[model samples]
Structures are given as C-alpha cells and as structure tokens.
Target: MKRTTIIALMMLFGISFSKAQTSPTAEDKIHSFVSIKNPPTFPGGMAAFYKFLGENIKYPEQAKKENIQGTVFVSFVIEKDGSVSNVKTVRGLGAGTDQEAERVLGLSPNWVAGTLDGKPVRVKYNIPIKFANKTAK
Candidate 1:
C-alpha cells in the first residue's frame, strides 16, 4: 500500500511539472513588444532591415505618378522559431501602396525571436515604412 501510494504521487507530480514547463506554441498567446526582455531583430539589425525594405518595397507606378506618399505601419508576430506570420498593415495610403507594403513585409526572412525571462517567445512587432517618390516634395 505504501509503495503504490508513493508511485501514484510521484507520477502526479511529474505530470504537473511537465505541463507547467511547456514551451510556447503556435496557438499560444503572443507577448507584447514592451514585455519582451530581448526584442526580436532582423538578421542584420536596423540598418540591414531598412536596406531589405528598400530593396523589396516598390513604389506603385500610379502612386508615384500621383505623388501619393505616406508611411505605412505594418504589424506582425515574430514567432519563437523566428518565423514571420500574421503580416498586416495597420495604417496605409491605399492605391496599391497597402498591398505592396504587405507583400514586401511578407517576403522578409526570419528574424531573431524575442525572449522573455530568457526563453524565446512570440512577439508582436510594428514597423512604419515610408513611401516617398524620388520627386516627392
């Protein structure tokens, strides 16, 4: 009786421990940017990040011709595995600029995942992309 009781308690304790220490999952809650200890980063930091945006984002011909310029705020989740997902434009200037911004952002390579309490976590990130024609005044 004593041995059976001890084994049952140990098994119960082990199961609870495993459940509590589980890592974040794809459907797991996303941590806000402000709460992250180490925020996610592009492969080469801000400069490289901007360079990538510049190289990928193309100004719409119509927008360029009409001189429609503004900043597009893109938001997404950087997953614990460094994959980009849920890309969206929070604020956009319409007229193809919105679609272009989303497209370029979706093309981005994986980033360094953010961390909280020293463990990798999914983080919500936002970036403002400026759309300015060379001739914009």
Candidate 2:
C-alpha cells in the first residue's frame, strides 16, 4: 500500500512539473515595438525594407487608370522565429491598394526577431505604403 501511494504521488508531481514547464510567461507574450528591448527589423534594416518595397510593389492597373494615389497602412506580427504573419491593412486607398499592400507584406522575408530581456519574443509592427499614378496624371 505504501509503495502504491509513493508511485501515485510521484505521478502527480511529474504531471504538475510538465504543466509548469509548458506554462507561458511574459517572455512568451507578443510585445509592442516600444515595449521590447529590441524591435524586429528587416534583415538589412529600414533602407533595405524600402528598397524591397520599391522593387516588389506593383501598382494595380485599375489604380493607375483611376489615378488613385494614397497610402496604405499595414500591420502584422513578427513571430518569435522572425516569420511574418497575420498581415492586414489597417487603412488604405481603394482600387486594390489594400489587397496589394497585404500581398506585398505576405511576400516579405523573415525579419530579425525582437527580443525582450535578451530572449526572442513576438512583436507587432506597422508600415505605410504610398501609391501614385506616376504616369503623367
């Protein structure tokens, strides 16, 4: 009977230990740009990010034809592993800029992960994309 009780207690402790190991803390939480020690960055930095945008951003023909010119604001999460996800346009000009902006962000390469207290953490980031007809309109 004593041996059975000892085994049961051991199992309970083991289960609780496993649960403790999996429990999340502030370190696991997604942090805002201003809150983290190091904000996430494109691999080469903001200049590189803009260069990538200029190279990859495609102006929708509909937008060009309509002379739609404005900025789209996109928001996304940089995960702990530096992957971009949950991309969305927070504000946008019509004529497909919203969807285009989201698509461009989806094509983004992984970023340098943000860190808090010297450990990697997820971060929320935002960017604004400007569009112009640029065709003598």
Task: Give the number of the best model, judged by lDDT.
Answer: 1
- How much lDDT does each candidate structure score? 0.88, 0.88
Write model 1 residue lDDT over 28-119, tens digit each, in one string: 87988887669998999989989999999889988987889889998989988998899999998987898998898889899999988778
Per-residue lDDT of model 2, residues 85-110, tens digit only = 98988998989889988888888899
Query: Model 2's lDDT to the true fold?
Result: 0.88
Write down the RMSD of all candidates, one decimal each.
Answer: 8.2, 6.6
Residue pair clashes in candidate 1:
none
Highest TM-score against the true fold, candidate? 2
Per-candidate TM-scores read 0.76, 0.78
